[model samples]
Target chain A: MNSNITHDLAVPLNQEDKAKRAFVTALRVHVLQHMSGSMKNRYEDYVKPEAQKRGNTCDTPEHIHKALKSDFMFKAYSSARTCAQEMVFDVVSDSVDREFETLRAKAKPVAKKGSLTLDDSVEIPKSVSEIDVHLAPGSYHAEYTEEDFATGAVYDNAIEVFSFGQFGKDSNDIGMTLSNYVRLKFPDFKPAKILDAGCTIGHNTLPWAQTFPEAEVTAIDVAAPVLRYGHARAESMGVPVHFRQMDATAMKFEDNTFDVVFSSMFLHELPLKDIHAYLKEAYRVLKPGGLLWQMELPPMNQMPAYDNFYLNWDTYYNNEPFYGTFRRQDYRKLLTDAGFGAEEFMEATMPRYTFVGEEAYKEALSGENTFDTLTGRMDPKGTRWYGFGAWKK
Target chain B: MRRIPRKRRGERNRFFQAEGVDELLSALLRLSAEVSALKDRVYIAEKVLEQQGLNVSDAIEAYELSAEQEAELAANRQRMIETVLAQFDNSSDVDDMTDENSKIEAAA
Candidate 1:
């Protein structure tokens, strides 16, 4: 159950920290799985009926959110969940503090194969600097000293605890699942250059390099600390990745430079305008006939009202203000507006490569979409990843 | 050591309607986490001692405390209880009272 980080730059946790992480993980599971069920029951049995009496249909996620504002069970669930979120970061940050020097030393060795390019001029976007996205303290950009990667260490370690082992052993299941899907689905298209945009610590980025070893893997993030840690992490793992500190919205890469531009769970953190800008940048950087695939939560329109309300909890409570807004947008239209041919736009629901083995996943791919209320959710029952992309022409 | 900020910016949402309830819940969860950590550490110590060929459970069961040790333990327990209960004590506020009569009355 303690599927903690195994990489070289992994923060060393004492017995108490490990236990705290376990407690937080359990608390999250209880809140998300068990208490969430109770909240839904309360809504269906009590809140929904009460709303109906007043001629309110409770037809949308916003309506459901408004109705549940006064519900005690919902309040308790939210409180517990928020506490778990804070506790996870607190425990991990403590561990990072204890081993700050050790981590810095570990991250010091120059990459033999991989490389890091940090830019001091890149302005930290307000979306990240203004608030701690997902309530992660420091928001992956803060640095106390020159060449500090504590925020990266915090993120890499805290997310493993936060995910509750749902994101695979290395917390790279999103990348692993999506990259493998592209490999299997389109066997003929061999990408020579790959780019992972907004790859925080390259947890999801490294899997793409592993999936396609021949590809020249490059990952970019606006934050320099994460890029520094990610560079060392990739080198320690013996994967050659080019880590650069650059914003995805306005990438430094030339036009048609990459055969594939990928992002996993990155877009939702951006404001609507930034999402569009990032898409345009992605389209510009991708070569003709190349792919721009992203692994994201399913759109709100694809889900029932209740599930929309459930998934959008992060938007309101988790400090991800743009989460619901991104989900509400038409994903296909977003791609088409970015200059991707509408006919070339494609989307798929594939099983998580690590959860369901490769063979089972391949078999499932040709089968039904297999998307339900649990798709893209952190629930243990949610085994599938929803991916949308368009081939540049 | 340089440490990342544990508290995040932005207005924190209050889930409970009553004042201080949310803070109380947070404190309760922290207490629970501490309890769980203690349990984990105990289990880890037992396993580690077992690996070193020490039967911890047997030793613990057979152990007997002398009078001095017992008194020390009792004092320690009392100290812990007092320390925990001291957080709820408002005597410090009364001590800081500017009015002389109110201080004497509060002490009584």
Candidate 2:
């Protein structure tokens, strides 16, 4: 009776679930990540100009998903989406490995490069300063020269792509789907200033522009390559988000400047202490009543056996050392410690499809397992979300 | 099928469990940090070794932290364990992931 045992349960997973798990997650991951041409061609085909024009990167999520309806495009999205993260991981990991070798060979005698050499004090921080932060090298530090700065971002982005897959804009729009639910539930859920930090490739950040068309949206990360890629993506998609290379802990913004500070799947990659620092920083940067939010793995206490197993898979062998730790902590208390008032927190699991039943999600509000990654396999009634919500005091 | 062994439970949890934020984990983790540091130390120490077959402890003088430093580091580690447990006893954020759902591309 170990729940982590792998297999589909009695819950009849439909075609969408099957495609997500079987085809996209499994088959597409290999091609998009390990192979190059196939993924590039597939991405171009999936996001043709016509399809992008139809997709609303500027409308509300409800309108965006509703207005952007092409059966073929949606199907292609489904096909390419799961491979999204896998491809990022493949590309970035391979690039970093090759580049790291060059870095080592060059630095063996002295810690200097040509016109691109980094400053003297600028050193790669030990990976274990706080915890075993991995699946990434060069973990976001200030650069001295032009070349090392580029090298740092290149390594970081490569690991991200390897971990994330293709970094596709369509897949990144999943957050906007939550915006659909938020809009329906709280029609007044509007924030004037939105920040998506550590937003590599800008795919996740662009969804915010669509989610709140009125909000001024900006996305930041330490890697310039992904920022450049994200910028081109924003220009091509016409989403109009400002992308910059910046660290999460020390973002280049004035205090209390944002109504909403959000990040997606970003916390677990950081060391535990770094997570605490980022939370404190988020509290510092948010407006008096601004909300702090994220869409990420569910807590460990709320997870069922199989779901816990699913969450564990990445943490174990994937070089993502801190992911499991991030999922297991009490987010409500964490937010409270960071500054939010108690009992101000809320969690929800948005519906999977327009017609999906509600019985599974009825008890979503009081710390259910909906938003957590493994929620599907564990909670029989279906999870609403492992979400914890709160408003700034 | 097969179960993961206790020796490898940490490894199992690393891969399988949602990231648990156990404060007590730093208890065992210190050893890993030491070993990770040692890997680099040993690599460089061996390179700087003047003679053949010097032990890791003997080679330590050639590197950053000596054997005496490691032992003292171990003592400081003991004090940290008690302090960590006493202060943050049950106040662990290691078990939670859902606060408020934001917009993102998570499969869940």
Candidate 3:
């Protein structure tokens, strides 16, 4: 956990942009500080140990089914708090959209650089959109099988947001914010083709679209519900990227199709076999000069003691079978073996706020914001989560 | 006569995790492990019943008929397991049961 967190970016973030970030930061603190007793109890009692187990025995989909049915106290708040909104699924979607809308309205045209191509090794099964994955009844129903796709009848609109929230700060909101921040940092560094593997609902995919307007951003997932939701979302947002019901491992696109293939919080859900396949697929699909970066849980090697224990909470207990493996893996080695260039792996923590309390943010525009300008995030936007990836160009 | 349909498995977990019952909780967890293993064995035995075309009633009768009959049933189970395990030794159907059994034994 050596602090390789250095920011000597040639250009700096501005006043208004910093303010939007702080709002989310304050929101995170708001939730953490002011979560009701029942909510607090939910985490300390059920969620904490559950996370500790990495969604293990107590974390089966059946467990969720059971909890939804019988855990009276647990559901009391969930039902109350979640009635109007569709849990984490919709709330963060709204927030990210709102933030981005602000960006677009202000004429901060997201700078773009490269073109995009499809990954050839992957194929979309005709029946992929048909079978009800994990027995959710209708989420993954295919077009040819049911004519549901053409009818425009999509299912589980909120599931994408709800389940993503289960990702906590690994939330799509944080990924989009920081990813866009990266775009701003390297405006000239756009890839021809982009991929979002394990894209559930395409929230993270949307950010790439915002960042690289010209790139043919492709999002692929094995699950049909989220992919359908993502397709619908992209259409609704007026951001067109090819959304397909395809596995991240054996994508149908050609080799060297994309200049950049990235995933957000996707690698950990895969079994070890699939992870290898994905890495291979990533390598196979990327052009001779391409980049493969993923935003993932802080590797155990990159974090402190309590954080190791904290992050490994899932591996030990949560049903996330690969959390520990991913945290312990060497991305640089993984990339080099995959035939990528010397990788840049650094973690970035945005000031919770632009600099609400501190003079750093206000002073940022005045050319005085230091890398360590410790400003609190606006509200609940605690960017405790970290980002990592490798480059080929 | 509308009854509030009772829940299966209910809130017993909460009861076990409650205060002043550390030993009880430990024993329950240990027993759960035991039962979970027994379930695997039960699953295999049920499969045996299916293979033998013996329903639950027939299996019970064979298991209960006399000392000799009981021994015969036991032998049949062992043979069935041998065959099935050979075909799928790596299957969790048997080992999942055994893992839970071992946990129970260790706990006890």
Model-by-model lDDT, in order? 0.84, 0.47, 0.46
Docking class of 1: acceptable
State the lDDT at A136 in candidate 3.
25
At residue A10, candidate 1 shows an lDDT of 76
Candidate closest to the true structure, highest DockQ = 1
Query: Across the candidates, what are chain A's individual TM-scores?
Result: 0.98, 0.58, 0.56
Of candidate 2 chain A, the 10-residue stretch with the lowest lDDT total is: A1-10
- Compare the candidates by lDDT and give the number of the best one: 1
| lDDT digits (tens) for residues A288-315 of candidate 1 | 9899999999998888899999999999
TM-score winner among the candidates?
Answer: 1
TM per candidate comes to 0.86, 0.48, 0.47
In candidate 2, stretches whose alpha carbon ends up further than 4 angstroms from where it belongs are A1-169, A352-387, B1-108
**1 against 3, candidate with superior TM-score:** 1
Q: Native-contact recovery for every candidate?
A: 0.59, 0.00, 0.00
